[model samples]
Target: MIVVDGHCDVLWRLWEDPERSFSDGTLQAGAERLAAGNVRAQVFALFVPPQVPRGQRLKAALAMVDRWHGEVVENAGFRPLLWRDDVPRVTGGDRPWALLALEGAEALEGELVHLRVLYHLGLRMVGLTWNEANEAADGCGEARGGGLTRFGRSLVEEINRLSLLLDVAHLSERGFWEAAEHYDGPLVASHANCRAVHDHPRNLTDDQLRAIAESGGVVGLTFVPAFLTGGEATRDDVRRHLEHAESVAGEDHVAFGSDFDGIDRVVAGLEHAACYAEWADYLLRYYPASSVEKWLAGNWLRVLAARLPARPMTNL
Candidate 1:
């Protein structure tokens, strides 16, 4: 079966350490690791940290996008997926594929034009915030707990117009609902877990999970240790959150996000991208092969086919 990780920070990692190659073995998402993990397709997020001064945020995001094209997409074993039709090519072959995602709107700098440009540059997904407030909305880490702004609503409309994947992994609770109010079709919490299980701000509440399910969306069970346990996390923690998400959202909405290169600490049995193969084995003890197949790649494929634009978008 093919494995599709809904989220990772390899570009962010490569961007941070300029000398490192995308295939560098030291990196968690290095070429060797991804090959060993057998992760046939992966989502690489362009995450501009909140502290980046407003003036330079766009440049920072663009640089990562450049690396995505230069490094990840240019690699021999990887292919970039920019259309709904591209899904079959990746899953049907041995070569790994990639989808681009923005972890926060801070990179857009309050401009819808930039959103279009990013989409044109192969950005298939957009996450509104990354743990701090931006023009779009308050992130989960924001104490004020506000919802989407007028600009945020417009951003959602633009995302809809472009047929981009909407991610709510770090939005504040109120912000999540407000965005949901205006955005039709499915949404992906690309790298979030169940708050009902771990109680982290990054995790989605049962209501949020159900909302995703009701909309025919998918939720990636992240491997962030702090979100899983008070200390080091294990595959069992992943199982618990997966089971909880399945219970509330039903099986269709559940899948793996991994949050691999983005995080510092690691889950005990899941140390890097390659470990996904092992994690899949751990999951099999508790689930049937068919169900495990969906959690690994099939469910995410379902979302891609339904959410991606049928042809190259020209609405702008």
Candidate 2:
């Protein structure tokens, strides 16, 4: 299967410590597992925390992407994938493809011009907010639940103009609807779950799920325990979310978004990427193979190929 995860924090973690590659023993999963597990492409996000200095957020993000690129170039088994165009090449043989993404709009520093710079730097996928509000949009945790700001509107428009995919994973409810109602193309909740199942503000409400589906977007079911079951989330916990997401967003709009290396806690049986195959086995009982393919990776890829521009080599 050509698996494409919409989210992962390996890039930020690697930048924190380049000594530990995916092939290294420290992290849960790495480049080696991606190749071995038949993951065609994995989106490695440049997660910028709100606490980080505003001026330094973009720098930090770039540094993380650079670290991943260095690892891929130095390692024969790994391949760096900046655009959809490189997918064929990266997955042609046994190598695994790496796609760079931004976990928050903080990297843009509240300026649409900064977005252009980041896009030029090779960011194809962008999450409008993290757990806090910024110049771009409001996060789920924001007290006001504000929608896209003036600057955010410009950013979203520019993203659409440039054919860059917009993700509303951690956005506030207002911002989520704003993006859904305003954006003309496909949208994504790159790493989120159903609010009906978890009641957490971080999860998507039923209205948001339908909006995503109506907009022709997908919602990546997260692997965090709280989102899956709020207790000891096992393989069954993830299964419940998967089933619910399929029921709400339809089978084509559900996919795996293992916030690996970002969330401190993972579901009991889904601690790493290698366990995805096992997760697949568990899912097989409830869903058909075709439905499973879309959930595993196909849905996200289809959206990207349909809406976003191929990654330009100059940026990365």
Candidate 3:
């Protein structure tokens, strides 16, 4: 079975001070684990933390993107994929598909010019905020769930114009509603669980889930234990959120967004990317192969196909 994970913090680890690598050593979901699990593609998010200075955040993110790009360039087997045409080509051979993404719009630094710069750098997706308020949008973890700011609205316009995807995962309630109303394309909660099951701010509310579904978007059921069925979550706990998402958002909008290397509490059996097939096996008893395929990979590809243009990657 081919798996397409919607989000992972693998890039942060790959370029951090310690300098993580995927060349057959040192981590769980490296090239080795991915190949062993029959994984087709994995979206590695450059999730910028709030601890960094405002001016330096984008630089840090770009540094990570540059490092990954270098790895892809030096190794022909792995390539950076940004469009639908690249997807089929990257997944066709022994190569593992890599989709570059930004986990927060803070990297934009309240400037639209930065958006174009990041786009040119091969960023295909952007999450409006993390857990703190930024110039773009308010975050769920902020004290107040204020809506998108004026700059945030402008940011969305440029994002739509550039044909880049907008992720509302960490945005506040008001920000989410605003994004839904403003953006013309499908939305995504790259790594979030169902709030109906768990009351964490990181989880999505019922109305939020409905809005995404109505907009023809996908909700990647995150694997963080805290957001699962509460304390000490297991594989079954993660399944609970998936089942609820299928019922509310329908099977069409549910997908996997394991927040690997970013979260502390991961379900027991579903600890890493390689365990994707194991989770699929357990889900098969509850869902058909066709349904599982849509949840695991097809739904995500559909969202990308709908949002991104057929622009070619020119800059190396």
Candidate 4:
């Protein structure tokens, strides 16, 4: 299967530790492991934590992007999945394709010019906040639970105007709705589960799921234990979350985002990218081949086809 993970934290992990190998088994979404899993197209998130000093946050994010370009791309031989047409290059190929993503807009520092710089550097996806308030919007974990700020509303317009992917994975409920209202184009919750299933604040409500579907977007079911079950989470928890997401968002709007390397705890039997093939097998018993195909890769492919710009901004 030509699997595509909407989010992973390999870039941030690599930036944090310069000595690690991009293809080694140490990281959950290591290049070699993803190849084993047939995850041909992977989105590596350049995550800058809110804990990073305000001025240095963008520097940290840029450093991760540098790791992505200088290390992973060079050592792993992964092609950049720049345009929708670029998808076919990784189909059954020996090497996987890499798509750069920003997990939090703090790196942008409330400036659209930096967004253009990242876009020029091959950043295709952007998430507004991590777990706290930023100039863009409030995160789910923020106690105040505020919506998108005035700057955030403008950011949405700029993201849409530039034809970049907007991810609402960690946004507050009000921010999500506001972003949806501002962005009529496809927007994904790149690494989120169903809140109705586990009741985690990070997970999306059924209403949010439907809203994503309504906007022609996908919801990536992450493999975090806390978001899966109160007790020990296993492959079955993944199945249950997928079932709930499919029930709420329909098969067309559900896909996988491992959140690998970014997460401290992973579901049992789903330790790394290589384990996704096994997860796909388990899902087959519950869903049809076609639906399973969508969940594993097709849904994400559909979103990219619709959202990615037809031509590259070579002049910029």
Candidate 5:
């Protein structure tokens, strides 16, 4: 089966530690491990740490983008997904495809021109905030729980105009609703769980899940143990979250996000990408082949096909 993971922080890891090899098994979603997991395509998030000086955030993002170009894109085992047509080329191939995504709007530094530049640089997805207030919007961790800022509204419009996938995984409740209300395109919570299963703030509530379903978007059921439960998470905990997500979002809207290198703890039996085949087997025991396929990659494929631009655009 071809798996499409919506989120991984391997690029941030590579940027933080230049000596690390993507093929090395030390990291959760290393290229070798992704191949073993049957992951045909993976979204690599360019996450700028909050501590980075404000003026240097864009530089950090560009550096990670360059790292992606040098390491994953130029490598024979992986291809950078520059357009929607690139999606099918990964299936049955010896290697996986990589898609670039921005985890936080800080990279834009409150500038829409930078957003356009990043889009042209092959960034196909954008998340407005990480876990705090930014020039664009309020994140899940914000105490005031505000909605999208004036600039954030414009950014959302620009994202729709550019046909980039809008992610709501870390948006505050108000911000999420604001996005749902304005953006008239396919949406995704790249790496998140169902709040109905676990009360973590990072998890989406049933209403939020249904909203995504209604928009013909997908919610990537994440592997973070803390998001799954207050205790150690097992395959069963993962299963519960998926089951509840499917119930609320519908089968077509639920897919695996597996926060991979971005997370500190993983589900007990699913510690790395290589374990996906085993995880799929466990899922098969409960769901039919069709449902399992949707959860694995089909749903994400549908979103990509529907939302990504038909051809690469020129800012000129």
Candidate 6:
């Protein structure tokens, strides 16, 4: 089966340490590990940490995008999916595909044009906020629990106009609802779990999961141990989140986000990208092959095909 992981911080890691090789095994999403896991496509997130000054966030994001082009694009066995049509080419070939995603809108610096600039740079997915309030919206970490601002709603409209995937992974409850209400395009919680299974701010509530399902989007069940439970997390812990998410979101809306390098602590047996097949075997025991196939990659592919623009956008 072709596996498509929804989120990883490998680009941020590479930007942090320029000498780190993509083939390095210590990283959760090393190129070798991805190959071993049979991952057909992996979403690389451009995550600007909150500490970066607002003025410099855009530059930081561009630098990571440069690193992606400089390093990953040069790799022989990898291809970057710049448009929806690029998906089939990569999936049908022997090489692995890389999809660009913005983990937070801080990089946009409250300007809608910056979103267009990033889109030109090959960004296909965007998340409005990371863990705190930005100019666009309040995040899960915000104490006030506010929703999308006027600018945030406008950004959602622009994202729809551009035909990019809108990710609601770290939005506050109100912000999520705001986007859900306005944006009729493809939506995804790139790296979130079920709050019903584990009560964490990052985990989506059952209602949130159902909203994603009803929209024909997928909830990528992540591997964050803390989001899985208060105690140490194991493969079974991952199973619990998946089971609960499937119950609420239905099998078609559930998939693997992994959160690989983005997460600090790892699940016991499913530590890195290379171990995905092992987890797949475990999931197979409980779910039928067809359901497991959807969880592995089909669901994400379906969303991408539906949401991505048919023709690439030109200079405006």
What TM-score would every model get versus the actual structure? 0.97, 0.92, 0.94, 0.96, 0.97, 0.96
What is the C-alpha local distance difference test score of each model? Answer: 0.89, 0.78, 0.82, 0.87, 0.90, 0.89
Q: Model 6 over residues 1-316: C-alpha lDDT tens digits? A: 7799999999899878888867666689988898889998999999999999979999999999998877776863578776667666655778888889999899999999999998988899999999999999999999999999989999999998999999999999999999999898767999998888888999999899989999999999898898899768999998988888888889999998998887788899888998988878988888899999999999999899889777636621
**Candidate 3 residues 1-316, lDDT tens each?**
7788888886787767545666645555667666666668777788777788988988888887776687643552566667656655643676677778888788878888887887877888888888889998889989988989999999899888888888999899999999888999998889899989989999998888888898899998988888896778888888888888888998899998888878666789877777887888888988899999898888987888788767555622
> For candidate 4, what is the TM-score?
0.96
Whole-model alpha-carbon lDDT for candidate 4: 0.87
Inter-residue clash pairs, candidate 6? none
lDDT of 5 by residue, 1-316 (tens): 7799999999899889988977666789987888889998999999999999899999999999988887787863577776777666756667678899999899999999999888878899999999989999999999999999999999999998988999999999999999988898988999999888889889999999999999999999999988989879999999999889988788999999999999887788899899999988989999899999989999998999888877735621
Count clashes in each candidate, considering only residues at least 3 apart in sequence or on different chains. Answer: 0, 1, 0, 0, 0, 0
The superposed Cα distance between candidate 2 and the true structure at residue 73, in angstroms, equals 5.2
Worst 10 residues of 6 by lDDT: 307-316
**Model 5 reaches what TM-score against the true structure?**
0.97
| Candidate 1 local lDDT, 1-316, one digit each (tens) | 5698999998888888899988878888778898888888899999997678998998999999999888887864578878888887777766788899999999999999999999889999999998999999999999999999889999999999989889989999999998888887698899889888888888899999999999899999888998887578888888899999999999999998988888889999899988888878888888999999999998999999889877645732
Which has the higher lDDT value, candidate number 1 or candidate number 3? Answer: 1
Off by over 4 Å in 5: 312-316
The deviation in Å at residue 125 for candidate 4 is 0.4
lDDT of 2 by residue, 237-288 (tens): 7777777888888888888788888878878877877777777777788778
Candidate 4 per-residue C-alpha lDDT over 46-97 given as tens digits, one digit per residue, 9 for 90 to 100? 8887678878977898888888887678878888877867765656657778
